[model samples]
Target chain A: MNAPVLAVRNLTKLFADAARPDAMPVGVRGVSLEVARGEVVGLIGESGCGKTTLGRCIARLLDPDSGEVLVRDVPFSALKGHSLRNFRKNVQVVFQKPETCLNPRMTVAVFVREALRNFGIVANNAEARKRLVELASLVGLREAALEQYPHQLSGGERQRVAIMRALACEPELIVLDEPTSALDVSVQAQVLRTLKDLQTVVGTSFLFISHDVAVIRYMCARVLVMYLGVVVEEGPVEAVFGRPAHPYTRALLAAAPRIKPRAVDPIALRGELMLGDVRLDECPVRVRCPLAHARCVEAPPEFDLGDGHRSACWLSADTASRSVSPTAMKAAS
Target chain B: MSADAPLFQIDGLTIDSIRADRRRRIVQDVSLCVAPGQIYGLVGESGSGKSVSMMASVGLATTGLAVQAGTVRFGGVVQQAVDQRGLKQNLSHGISLLFQNAKGALSPFLATGAQVGRVLDRQAIPRADREARISELFRVVGLNHADLGGKYPHQISGGQAQRVAMACALATDPKLLIADEPTTALDVTTEREMLRFLKRLCEDRGLAIILVAHNLSLVSEYCSGLSILHAGQVVEDGDLGAIFDEPLHPYTQGLIAAVPDVDEPHELIPIAGSVWGGSADIDRCRFSHRCPFAMPRCDAGIPTGIRTRGRNVHCVLYDEAAS
Candidate 1:
């Protein structure tokens, strides 16, 4: 819609261990997605599913081996010098651990002030100080918290400072990698609210990466489910969560313990967890898919479920026609 | 109070940390009880003393921290401290602890099987049967003995390592297990699997477990009862479903509301005000500074827990209702 704030097409990144260079573990393979302006898009997957790699690639923190990244129609992957600096200013990243993301020696003010200075936005210390206070207030941090070091601050406060640093340059898109996963429920709530409030105010598009399905459902408008570097499913958050088409997505939803148990029988995924990529022709989840068949071993089809909901699975056509539940499919398989 | 006494009970447990010759009460009159085959959750934000109180219960409290006041009653016996050398054998026979980072807790030098054998060694189990017992424990925890038992802590995945740790913890056949964020390091899928296994362990073996976590939903789903800690004090503690249905404490209400519900997505209402350690120095309500419904009386003294409808809440609102 109106040229997405950020766009990725056929992104691929391979990470090979130095000792074992011949067998490269899969890291974000042929992933294509987009984040509309002011929209919160969720990237959900289990650990080592390449969600973080995808976030880092989009933030330009890591260079992808292939594919293209377009920031508001401007090519991001090929930019250099001044264009690269401008693109960096247009996007920012906040990591899971605020302690590591921030310097222990630096005060909260300096941590955020440095971001502004690096962006060349503030001219002098006075201007920087003013902006720092403003940023702190924007994230619900008190004025005095700016004087304390990261260690002196609470986990939630440190996370707020991290968010403020991301917002310091006023980027058009912010990539949040498990920002609230580290904090407690109450503190996580505060951080989540602060983020939602800030997004509303700044209208910044966010690529939220988290393994927490509930947090993703609450904070993101659109959801993308990844498995072994592949975007197995993508759809509106409610649609995907309410009626997940992909077997992996459905399994994830069922696995996550909810406040209230669902009426459907829990789909117990069979087979051991397969790490990295060994073969690319068939579906990545074929080994673990409870409903796997010969077709799954041959080809992975991306089926359109309408309303921007799509999934890669061999049972998509049959499931679509029958609208069979995950438990039913599991029982049949 | 001895009628079917809890498997493990801690009452009025106060912990103080002394630094630079100044004593600060970190945990104020904390207490909890766990019965056989029950999952008791202790939920709180970081620095809320949930971990500290737990560590104190097991006698693993860090240096400079002391249990100033409290009684730990385990298996119908009142003990001064859990880590007392005189009670080492009894403690080993009765209690087990699981940490957030199982790899760090495990000895890197020893193979996974050897570590479990060591725990068995503590129980004076004959060396001949230790191997068989280790495999049995691994099987109980859903681990392949040959594949996982031979690997070092570094070799196994985080989830597998955690299961290895669980196998070691269960080596003594302990009656109660203190699991402090035991599943925190694993992915959501792994976490669910681990938790389900733990639940089955409790039900099948009659092992009482204290599940400490910050995720309200996880605690709610798995635990039957829980204690909500705020700034080292138990703001509320009772039936998990009861608290979820009608949380009496403002802190508990805020914490519950803050959790992102997958089924019913709504705007999160984050509790205002950061919890500062220095605030604990005051004798008043620990959460008053951040409490939305705080009144002038809340700053007077620590509110005592008031029981209502099978749950206990230490807040002025409940205090008023009690009066």
Candidate 2:
């Protein structure tokens, strides 16, 4: 496999807490992943699963506590001064809520061109305006849309403007944080298609972060599932979707509301690893997993289930192959 | 109507919202029935008046929003048309509402127990009786009343908070609970637990519900009957399975097809146009432009509400059979 355009290794982000001690209860524990040019890697989990935090950390919006964020083999975290500025230009982000993300005062054209002129990506107003039009057009926004403010455009239009602004820097990576979650289901489909089209035209790698698993299933080529601020599962989207190996991933798939949930048993987790009846090393999934035994408590890091796919559970090859149906709830008593 | 009949019944309801320019009809001659122990689903996008139609029953209508004409009968008691009296006076004890946000449902200052008890206390329940009412309410919504009364809003998780909100709605021992996108704000696991708790609560003691949501898949899980709202009107209303199998209105079919399902891998066909809100073209149909099956005849005539396949559809495509 070719080396990825962006490789995040042991990417841990910890914010100092005023309430809790700095050492204990850090936000994001050791997280690791990659994004190849023209490839879309989806980050899926519930809110506070470190999806947004991870995106911010990768975009260099927030500094990591301990880990490496490599861009074109050069460490992004290692850069200082103008190099850091360059790194920022290399990776831009479109936040989850477009309404709040876009400045109410700034017109859409100004919003798109701000990044262009600031990054020195374009020399002058004429050059910046010309580039802004192209970026807007790439994301399916009209040149006339530039004259309108964020509030004037519809929810779909505003998001397209947000996407256009993200592309204005001509970044190699775009950390899209729940780009379509707020929009209506119909409008969301259009935005997703636009994102796909933009990726094809520009070959920009996206770290699309969302709490909804179904959305990532349709849009992303690869998927990464996180829990309790840790990478629980990571592999091909279809593999993780069709044959989800991780207990958490399987549970998420089962718990996800089906198109038609006639007589379907809802997936119930035992609880979060930190709060539930289990420890991190003992298997983060032990609390919720019905297949868990005493052996899971002493399991090593990531028991490979063949291929690149991996799970942290201590279940043996034979036991894992048994294929327990996740349809049954853990039965909360 | 007997008490054994549906909790809420509306034969012909027309809810309208007032814009600055003029009065515009929103929910046009809509009608549906929510029987006791039934979870009736209301599905539609924003501006579809799904929220407005249900919110009208609960007496929480937004400003510039008024039921110019709509009959809302809750617990066999008919609400007076568009007056504050219809909501607070007659159906006060009969109905309660749960908003999409649990945090918003609960006041930040008040504790969960206090909030739940507040609903009943408003109707002149003694302070001493409030404690017992709070406890029973918590049990009804599947929350531990044991010392949970003292904790403030921020102290609990979202699922627990919503459960507390459910407890609040149950405080009046309401016959009908109107939940507006209740699960929209929750995670999948938390949402599952919430719905299960609600279903079980409904099963144990009979309580009617009007669950408003955009996703039909979610509505199909629990709802026996459904009303699909579009452009501030009931485009389709009736059996959940029948509509899923054979939706009469093109808008209903489009809205149902838009939801992306986890179990079922679909191409996710999105509806063509955004909802129009200023004012209807008056003569022209609301969904005339966006509907794939729309014809030239649709632009000229106002589609009359008609029944097809046991469900009411408001569209020109179904006009031939209805006419």
Candidate 3:
């Protein structure tokens, strides 16, 4: 569309063990996805599936071992020193644990002020407080909340504070790293609403990361599903979530509760990981795919199902025609 | 009001906490009843003290806050107000806990089956039946018993580990299961499977449960009766249907309003304030300060009574005059 506000290309981040360089420490392999301008993209996967690491790397919080992260056509990996500072000002992040992320020693006002001061968004305390209030108001936080410490604020309020702090610099992109997972359901809604409202008003691109499919489906218009640090499926939120072409995506949809449990709901994966510790000759998801035949283990390629939908599974093209297109998938734009 | 006698009854329990030498109400006079086979869901936000109340009733919460005044009558017998041995004994064989993080709950070195077996052994089950019982429990929780029980905590996936934890809980066929954020650590699909399995197992075996969690829709979909805890107080308690369709309490309304519905993507209107921990100024309604629909009389009188719809609401909004 608009050449995505953020574009990632072959972004692979590896955590090589200090003791054993060959050994991978949790986040391994490499992958890349992008967020379009004024678009909410959900990165959905299980815990420790590299979604968090991807968000961090996009926000430039974690340097990729060997991958490229591009913000607005500018390769962030290519930046250094002052250029990196400019890149940092363009992209910001909000963590899952808002209270822990916040400085308990600082008041809510000071927290927002730190971001503004660091980014040169404001010069004086009065101006900083003014901007902080505007940011706080966007998230439905109270004036009195500014005076209170992180500990004094409620879980929801603390999250709002985190969002305000993230927005203090007025970045073009925000890495929402399970921003509301720690919040109460009610507070989570409020924070998400604030995020959506902020996006509508600011036109900021969001790389929303969450393990909750329903939440991702609700907040994001496009989504990319991750498995073991690899992008197995990526497509429009409605299309992919409605009728997941990928076997893993289909399995995840089947596993999600809400609708009545199906007597014979097909599981996406067969057992364990798509690709074990060692890569197979076949597709990573094939070992778990119900449709996996002898063709599975032989390096299955991602099938282009058109309509901006792509899946890294051999059976996607064959099975996409048969799977039920859930009505929830059609509820999106 | 539904069914009289239940497997476990936490009647009018109040837990007072002393933080920095200050006495405060952490769980204020919460009373709930879980039927023999019913899943009595206790839903609320982080500070709602859902965890503390459940833990305290079973003598598992923070140490300082004593059960100021309440009775935990399990198996139709009144245990001491806060006896470690008594509550634990009542909770051990009679009830078991399942946390969201099962990996942390288990030992890294020991086999998954060994963990479950150890618990069964502690409950007087013979060691010889451990493998059979472990397999049964594993199958019950949807794990591949034939292959994975011998594996360690790290051996299984998140969903598998959670099932292993569930297997450990089911080792004794305990009368009641206390699952605190059980599926919080699992993926959405795995979480869905776990929920279905747990609910089905409970129904099939008549296993009563005290399911304490923060998810309202899940509780609404599964639990029959629930108590909404807020700032150490149960602001609302009744049938899930009534609470969702027509909530009487402001806090309850606020909570329900916050859930981002799948069909309806409305922005979340988060509850305005934080929960008071160990605060002595709990004379008025615990939610009075943040209740947008609060009345002047609310500051003067603390609301603690049943609503018109046969539901308990500890708020001034339910007062006859306010109504």
Candidate 4:
């Protein structure tokens, strides 16, 4: 098989609290994932669960303290000067707030053209103009809207412009960090549909990061559940969401407000997410896990559950071997 | 008051934002009747005037906005909505409001406990019982008074700050609580917890709540009845279950179709055009521009509510007499 478009190896980044230096720094820790060519991989987590940090780190917007991000087997950090600048063209990032990310002074056309010219993606003004129109249409923006400034456009339009700017570079992979969370449901639907179609047309891999589980389920083929800086569960979207292995994943799915109510009672988590010292030896979610046991004091390895599904919980070992139901395991515990 | 009587009622409410001698009607002919201990949802998009209607109903309409017409009936007393003083007096009677940003709403200088204490002081609770009452309020919202009471708003997490805000709103033992997107800033689990807490408060204290939110699914889960507002008009209002099951209005159907369902994966059909806020005096259906089945009659005037299928829907297609 061809190499994955983007591969992150044991990436770790921590933000030291200057005011409270002794407090445990909060950020991604020893997280690793890969996005195959043209694949959409989703990262789901609550606020401050390090999903955003992970996205930023992968996009190289924020330098990681450790680990390496490789683009098609080429390490990002190994590239230097001109090579590093060239490597950046392979990945682009779309932030949550379009108003903040976009330049108020520049029109949508000029904003997108800047990216095209900066990367030398277009030969001349004629080509840039043509590319700008193409990019705008790709993200569902009308040609007329390209002439308007960020302030003149609506929230949905501004977001589409941001996406257009990212696509201007013709990057192989795009990191979308809560791209549609700020939008209204109707507008969000339009943007998501546009994105899904754009992905197929462009064949660009997407690392979709969002707190909304329903969106992740809809957009991604594979899913990773993050908690307190680590991936607790990772697998096919159907296998993971349909039959979640981790306790956090179950609680998150249960907590998501659904149009159709669930047949069974939602799995109630214990308490709110508390950010403290990151103890690598212990399970990150043990404090909130309803079925947490003494074995959880020591961190569990990623137990393979076949079909490429893996969960960082000791209980999965019984399920993999004995095919014991999760409910039965909960009952036993 | 009778057990079944509405705790709070707003009738034919209209609000106008006046600037430079020009008046733009922001909220028009909006009405809602919330019974005691009932959770009524006011669901709409940003410019739909959900917040404006609620604020004007309580006489807290911001600067440059004039309450042109409406009457608010609370507990057996009826007063004109234009009477600011009369509406303001209802706060003392039993009305409390909760905003989306709990931290911004809270006093930064005051400790969490002191904030709740200040509300109690305003309500004329005995000075001797203020501290105990504050602690009880905190506990009631599922926060530890001893641990979080002394912390300022900035020190605590978002969830704790929201609980502190909830405690302050509950200080007067309010009969009607107007929570405007209270859980929008919270995490999914935390939002669920907060909504559940609010539901329990309604059941235990007979607290009537008007939950104003832009999220249809969140409102669908907790609220028994709801009013879907669009461009300052009540497009649909009635039982939540009936509307969710068979949405009559085109805009309502578009909204329900737009929301992504977690349990069921289906194609999302977004409304073609954005919300259009029509001119104040036009009196036409604001949603007519985006309505797929728009007819010439839709341009004539804003369709009044037509009772059908156990709900009130305002649309030309639902007009039985016209048909």
Candidate 5:
């Protein structure tokens, strides 16, 4: 098999709260994942769940406290100076807010050309202009928009420019952090379609990070459901969203509003999410889980559910041992 | 007022923005009716005039904007919408507003309890009963009064702060509440909880709510009736179920198709162009420029509302005389 484009193992990044020393730090915790070449992997969670932190760590924008990030089997930490600069070309990031990331003074063409020149993707000005036009069309940007500044562009156009800049490097992997959340529904659809088409045409792996469940389901072949800095569930999109094993995942799916009214009542959780309320030794979601049990006091290990599906919950063990369905278990609880 | 009469109604509401001595109609011929205990949704994108129309209906249209025409009826009392003084009086008559950003709307210097108390004070509840009413309002909104009352806005979570805003809105025992994108700042779970709570409030108190939002799915889940606004004009209005089942307007169809569904994945077909805010005096369909089926006559005049499929749709395609 060909090597995966990006591989992360036991990645941990914690931010210390100096004002509240006793409070648990907020950031990504011991995350492990693999993004095969041309694969779209989704990371979904509510605010402060560390999905963004994980994306930043994978993109090397922020250094993780421990663990390894590998690009095509090459350790990200081992690269230095010129080698690191060359290696960085393999991964790119598109932030949530394009306005802040884009330079206000540069036209769309100049902004994209900067990436090309920095990576030496184009040798001459003529080639750079040609590449800029190609990248713009690839991302569904009008050739005319390349001449306008970021401030002159619409929200959707600005985001497309950001994506174009990232694609300029011809990176093997791109980390998109809530790329379409700020866009209108119509504009968001256009951008998401463009991204999907670009992925197919360019064959670039995408680490799609978003809080919108439906978007993640639409864009990703596989998904990781995170909660309080831990991945509670991971599997094929169908296996995870269709037959979610973790209670948190079930609650999240239930909570998301659907265009078609849901047939059943949403599973109401116990309370609002309170960060730093649980110790690392305990399950991060037990405080809010309606079906939490005594076994949930301790952190559960990820149980393999076949088809590459895995869930970190003690109830999955019961489902495996007693052949009890998760729904039946919930009723019993 | 009769029990069956709409709690709040706005007819032929028109608004114009005066910028550098030039007049441009921002909202024109907008109309909406909300019956008691109904959750009516006003869905549109930003700058589409959902907020502007609602604000003007309540006489809170921002400076530099003029209310040109229309009539507002509250509790069977009719008054011209252009009468800002008369419309401002509606605020005291069982009408409350909840904005998008709860934290920013809240008074930073005051405790949550004091904020709620201030509303009661304005309503002239005797000083003796103000504290009890504040606590009751907190409980009604599902907040622990003893815990959150004394805390400042910054001390509470987004959901809690919004509930605090809800408590303030409810302090007057309002018959009609205008909540403009109330849950846009909240997480999905919290957003659902808030909407569910609002539904319960309507059921328990016979309260009518005007839920203004840019999200179609969110409104579809909670609102019974809705009006789709485009470039300040309501292009579609009526039964939510009917609109969802068979949307008639081109703009409505495009908006629904653009939304991504969690339960069912389908190809998204975005509208071709952004909304074009034309001159108020032009008297044409605001959505014609973006409409796929735009015709030469669509440029002639505004498409009047046509009744079909248990709803009202404004489009040339629906005009019996045109086609």
Candidate 6:
């Protein structure tokens, strides 16, 4: 296919633990992924699972300690000054909390207009006003909303402004970090529909980061399941969700609350995510994985499970041979 | 309709507020009856007044709001009024509350153990037995007393802190627990664990719980009965199985259709029009403006509750069924 819109290779970030200076906390450890043009790729993980950090790294909001972020065959990590500013205009980010992200003093109109001005998209005042109105209409916001301040607008309205601002410069790739988690379900639906419509109209790829599995299933065609800063599974949404190869992926799918109860009770994942220390050699989810073995101490390689499905687990390595019985799997959890 | 009286019951609960010199009904004619050992759900979106109604029932409604009409009865004892101080004094014996943010509800200065111990102290438990009782409560909520007891509120994780809060709530051995979005702030796994613990608690202790949450799926799984609120009015309330499987009210249908189901993915159609929270005519149907099947008669008068199958739905569409 044509060059992917966004490609990240071995991105790693380390933060020092205040109490234990010797232990280095890996925010995004050696994460490599790609998002094709117009594709809505989902990144799912619990809080502090490095999904947000990875998104920020891709958007260049946070400088990665090491590795490369390429935007359409261009090495984004190497760009500096004017070129970097230009690169930033192509990639925009919408955070989880809209109230904090939006300026309290700025009106909805000025927010979108300011973004257009930063990108140098509008020629004059007339052009900026027209563009701002168009962006507002695109996100299903009324013209009256443009006159209101951030505090005056409702949660759903403020989020619309945030989305409009992200779309102000016509960014090719938008990173949405838990955009709907804050809004009520009814309001979330409206915002999600707007996002889907805009993506189709603009052909902008989305790196959607959310802990809500249901939202991810609805919006994303492909998904990456992260555990402790490492992606344990990556594949087509249907393939991965239908037959999850990794233990972590299984736990997540099982944990998600469904409208209708499942035929069999879902396996409840016991224990919390173990953070701190550098167990670089071993699998990140090994501590919580039910099928963890002695071989897990040494990092498990990403095993191909056919049809572009891959999982980082020792049990999945020999799944092609069907050596591990179903009973063995049930006994472990 | 159980042989015995409900553990907690509220009827014709109407709360009004004066904003901008205009009287508005914030919670209008909302009612619920929770039987012992039954986990009843009060499901609604923000500004729906689900939280307000619960707060009013417990005499916790903030100032400026008055209960014009409503009777709260707990264990055959009728409360004087919605905001009567005696309601708390009488109900405090068997009613406890759990909020969304356990960390915020907990005192920053006190140790986790001391917090739970404080509740036991009010019950007049001997000082010598308080320590052992606190540890038992901790163990019941799946927490380790020895390790987490001494730590301050900031020291524990969100899930662990929530469990500690649960322990504190259970200290009074309450017969009825009013949990408002207890798992909303927690992770999916943690939420499930907490809900399961709650379900078990209901079965083992025969405790009745009023779970107020926005997530329909979470409420459906644990709660046997539910009430769906919209703009301060309970549009639908009854058996969870009936309301969820075949929602009658357009608002209830819209709310369910809006949530994306992971197990059964489908196109989510959001309800049109924002919830009208302003002072609408009390005689008219509140959701009539947003209802897709709105008729001229809907604006004529308020629609009373009509029984269909096994639930009560307040909608003009069900007028024929009521007749």
Which of the two, 2 or 5, has more TM-score? Answer: 5
Residue pairs with backbone atoms closer than 3 Å in model 5 (clashes): none
- Between candidates 2 and 4, name the one with more favorable DockQ: 4
DockQ, structure candidate 6? 0.74
Worst 10 residues of 3 chain A by lDDT: A324-333
Estimate, for each residue in B213-250, the C-alpha lDDT of model 1 and write its tens digit: 87777887789988988888888988887888888889
Off by over 4 Å in 5: A320-333, B1-4, B277-281, B321-323
Evaluation by DockQ, superior candidate among 1 and 2:
1
Cα deviation of A42, candidate 1, in Å: 1.1
Chain A TM-scores, per candidate, are: 0.92, 0.89, 0.88, 0.94, 0.94, 0.93
lDDT of 2 by residue, A1-333 (tens): 777889988777755445544223435676777788789999988866778888888888888888889987789977889879877888889877899889999999888788888889899999988888788778888778899998889999999988888888888889999999889888887888788877888998999998888888887888888875777777788778887767778778877776567475634575433343344455556667766777766533554555556555554345344332221111111
Model 2 lDDT per residue over B1-323, tens place: 12257778864566767788888777776678888888899888877878777766556677887667667776556765577565756776777788889987789999888888778777788878878878888877777788578898887778788888888778777788888899888888778778877787678888888888987778778887888777866777887878877877888777667776665557777777688832386566778777888788877865656778867777777778976
The model with the greater TM-score, 1 or 3, is 1
- lDDT: which candidate is best? 5
- The TM-score between candidate 3 and the true structure equals 0.86
- For each candidate, give its TM-score against the true structure: 0.93, 0.92, 0.86, 0.96, 0.95, 0.95
lDDT of 1 at A288: 81
Give me the candidate number with maximum DockQ: 4
Error of 5 at B242 (Å): 1.0
A222 Cα displacement, candidate 1 (Å): 0.9
Clashing residue pairs in candidate 1 are none
Point out the higher-scoring one by lDDT: 3 or 6. Answer: 6
Task: Identify the runs in model 3 with alpha carbons over 4 angstroms from their true place.
Answer: A1-3, A16-32, A105-114, A117-149, A257-279, A291-295, A298-307, A313-333, B1-4, B80-85, B89-91, B124-139, B142-146, B277-284, B300-323
How far residue B279's Cα lies from its native spot in candidate 4, in Å, is 6.4
- Using lDDT, rank the candidates from best to worst: 5, 4, 6, 1, 2, 3
Candidate 1 residue-wise lDDT at B147: 81
The reply for model 6, stretches above 4 Å from the true place, is A22-26, A276-280, A320-333, B1-4, B19-22, B277-279
Question: Residue pairs in steric clash, candidate 2?
Answer: none
